[model samples]
Target: MARMVFCRKFQQEMEGLDVPPMPGAKGQELFDSVSKQAWQEWLNHQTMLINEKHLNMMDLTARAYLNEQRDKFFAGDAIDSVEGYVPPSE
Candidate 1:
């Protein structure tokens, strides 16, 4: 299913679905509950991988662009030391 597709019952068509246990819901309370649960689960699984992939792709693209531009920039894998240090005395 598409990431943006909400399994929500209140979509434009309404699908003529009668909301079960209807109360407190604009159209159907049961639709609200079921849709919420399904969408939540869907979002949890889908969002994680898509977000991770986006971050990974962005980092790779940035590194590639930087590499093509200059070899004098910060080292790709170097650890930068923390400065302004004041160690607590024993």
Candidate 2:
């Protein structure tokens, strides 16, 4: 059976992850409160951030920046978008 959680990002009850995405208390919090869909959204946003900013994951500063963004994103706070990015018309 699938697990359920009250996804903080989406603000709705949804399917939960099988395990925390990372180590630490925050990871456990995400596993309990974030949904699979919201997590996938963050992955996409993180990818965009990485590409747009030319972020080098191996660099400590870059990793720290991403971590901050991840926390804000999951907390339903404002997150910066890629510079000069234009969303496609619907």
Candidate with best lDDT: 2
* Candidate 2 lDDT by residue in tens digits, 1-90: 899999999899999998899999979988999999999999999999999999999999999999999999988898998897788999
Lowest lDDT block of 10, candidate 2: 78-87
> What's every prediction's RMSD, in angstroms?
19.4, 1.4
Q: Distance from true position, residue 61, model 1, in Å?
A: 17
For model 1, how does the per-residue alpha-carbon lDDT over 6-76 read when each residue is reduced to its tens digit?
33333432222233423554235334333444434433433443444343536777445433322211112
**Whole-model lDDT for model 2 versus the true structure?**
0.93
Query: What's each prediction's TM-score?
Result: 0.22, 0.89
* True lDDT of residue 42, candidate 2: 95
What lDDT score belongs to each candidate, Candidate 1 first?
Answer: 0.36, 0.93
Model 1 stretches with alpha carbons more than 4 Å out:
1-34, 55-90
Best by the TM-score measure: 2
